[model samples]
Target: MSSRIREQLLSLLLEQGDAFTSGEEISRRLQCSRTAIWKQIEELRKEGYQVEARPKKGYRLVHRPDRVAPEELKPHLRSQRFGWSIQYHSQVLSTQLIAHDWARKGANEGSLVLTEEQTKGKGRMDRAWHSPPHSGIWMSLILRPTITLAQAPQLTLMAAVALTRALRRETGLDIRIKWPNDLLINGRKFCGILTETRGEQDQVQYVVLGMGINVNTLEDFLPDELMKVATSLAIEGGRTYHRVTLIASILQSLEEFYDAYLKQGFEPVRILWEEYAETIGREVRTETSQGTIAGMAVGLDPSGALLIRHQDHLQPVYSADID
Candidate 1:
């Protein structure tokens, strides 16, 4: 079955929520025959959609599984490119590992690899990312943008702004960005971004932008030590959201910001980042390779470096574990 048909069928059933749509009506609306509609409905059943079918009444969507697979996400995606093609896994060591392979193999921009569980997921500074099965969004998006190597780090900050906008818009939670790549609410973390790029001397070849979001994870799923610093949207929002819907929103937001960045440069994205940033105008203690640097967090330089004011000197930090 064509993916487009699957998307259209699911969308139709969802739009008519709690109402049974007839087979004849569905066929007419989709411009397909009754046989085709029935076949597609069967496919949906296999994909975990609880569709009710009667003799005359066509189908009613009873339940939609919270899966970020193509069937679930593509139906909600309105972006022209992002999420147009997707790869899903039930379990993987890391989405980043597969994404890197696909990037080298010439995966198109916006090709996404997502999974229900990641056994060995990682965050910045080599810390382990706790990814529970079916409780969060763990994925890597492949992007082949027309940007230089020096500007690749900006992708991390750009993604921070994009996801912040998406989460705040979708869930209405008060989320803020933590410098280069994390999102927090009420001084606790719910999302992290890890951007990896392969490039020539001055130009980028491809970027595998990885995102790990804690969405529906309940408090019991968290480790005892993580309860203080880690949290999920479900916990903060006091309810669960459809992971597929959130994924679609994030993809749309990323694509929008990405297009703007390509045309308008980092100035616009930087402004948005500052608006959502929680690290600015605060004292920061960052651990760099050279040594620990304690300074007052001020702003970001044009290239997306965190500018710190230490006594009389302004320092730009490219990579660090900031507090």
Candidate 2:
């Protein structure tokens, strides 16, 4: 209810595109109290929107900030389905987990679950993701595709490709995909992608594409252990960037690449992914449940599995803990 009201208020103000709006007029139109309208106005201000209030004039949206509200991001978003519907939480245990639950309850395809801060956020292989308050992009995308379970793994690579393209356009960061899903800049970890799916034996019900990118994380906020290994957009780009814009770009690219993948197969995205991939043709080591393997990263199979060229053998690694 509040979400609808907030969106409606934004739309009204955007349509008006004037200096100010009267409380009486807005309250009557929204079917809410003037106090309720004022509170929502305050909420928008808190999210970086510059809402100017006057005793006689009521409220005026002076500037639309670059936070990731559905309405604020709507004009910038270019996706047909991805992020068309969004659920934003100020703080949550995990957006990915919440997205999974929402998907189970029949959320639409490309529904976004996002949070400013994640308390129990996780990464690939149950690793704890460091998400400081309002410092990064901690979000999950719910994608319900008409594909077999085998094709699910390809989505992570697709996301990496999409995210890389966005970074290139937005920040112009020299980013690369580190094999399976990690995004790197200047040989350091800048982003991570984790793909989890829930479905039946031969069908995929919904897949959660969880992506975490260090946008503006401060050195003080990071754990002492990760300060050396992790890098943020602020660190790499040397400037502060709006997370909302980056997210909108990512969703747009994801939608484009996804549609192409569905029609033409992974060949196109595979080419793009390989071009930006840093791990391919590099000497690396990865840890699997079985053991550690030292090999040369050849490329990805059609299923998005890593093909490692070990001594006297070529192997397809299903899952690996990249080192």
Candidate 3:
């Protein structure tokens, strides 16, 4: 049950691959008893790993769990910092909330909080995001960038670009960004990004970039209300993908874009975002808290706000839904 022993056991299984490793060999290698090895194997099975035990041959790792465990991801992750330290949970109210706490406690800038399921996940305009277990990527990244509060919104656009590239490369699907922070495919939404910040008027302390991606969710698993407007990669691509691979790709892409944004400013990120935008040069209805404005989608302004050309003037919409 101890993390150290579990990790040691997992490392041994991974090293052996399909070959079986005897209990005595495992205990001697890990400096533990056969009873301790057995306990760890049971724990691995509880975590969804399929470990097979034979008469005298010993244990062989059959299949890894579908869930996104830190051990499963650490091997594939290449990011220097973004995914270096991960806080994983089987289920939580929201990864965003946990990330906020971690940021307040001085968690590293690139540390990530990821969960297999979210019971009360949040979205734009106080909407509820449905995050079923093992069906989607519900994660939040802690960022402590030295950017002004006005420039924080640009991070959302940067995330959209990162996710767009990652999804395109992974699924080979035509993934596009629906202005502000939604990722769409074939005019249906499959991902949403919410960037929350804590700071003074002139400076930002930290930003929590939360992302919800429906990766391997089946069509029938979706709620009836969401069937019209929402979809999953599995539904669109006709297959399920390895969540750990997608997560690794997303973190690598995000760190690349984040570093570029820090060194070169927002111009580079803005250009990349524009290339994948789905709302430009089309008619859109933007619903703000004040009211709804329907017009032609022009482009993004300097501050990353959506530029909508109304009847006779251009309006910059800071936050709204594109319909």
Best by lDDT: 3
Which sections of candidate 3 miss by over 4 Å? 24-35, 287-292
Give Cα distance to truth, residue 64, candidate 3, Å. 2.4
Candidate 2 Cα deviation (angstroms), residue 278: 1.0
- Top candidate on TM-score is 3
lDDT of 2 by residue, 1-323 (tens): 88678888998887778768899999999999988887888888887888878898877778976456576677668778899888988899999889988998999998998888889999988999988887899999998888889888888888899889988999988998887889988888879999999879989998999999999887677788987788888888889898888888999999998888889998888888989999888888888776777888888777778888887687788877666
**CA lDDT of each prediction against the hidden true structure:** 0.90, 0.86, 0.91
Q: Write the per-residue lDDT of candidate 3 for residues 1-323, one digit (tens) a residue.
A: 48778877887898899999999999899998899889988999998889999989999999987878887788789888998889999999999999999999999899999999999999987799999999999999999999999999999999999999988998999999998899999999999999999998789999999999999998889989999999999999999999999999999999999999999998888778888999888999978886888899888887788888887898899987678
Winner on TM-score (1 vs 2): 1
Candidate 1 versus truth, CA RMSD in Å, comes to 2.2
Better of 1 and 2 by lDDT: 1
lDDT per residue (tens digit) for residues 207-252 in model 1: 9999999999999999889999999999999999998889889999
Q: Rank the candidates by lDDT, best first.
A: 3, 1, 2
lDDT for 130 in candidate 1 is: 92
Q: Tell how far residue 105 is off in model 2, in angstroms.
A: 1.0
Query: Considering summed lDDT, which 10 consecutive residues are worst modelled in model 1?
Result: 1-10
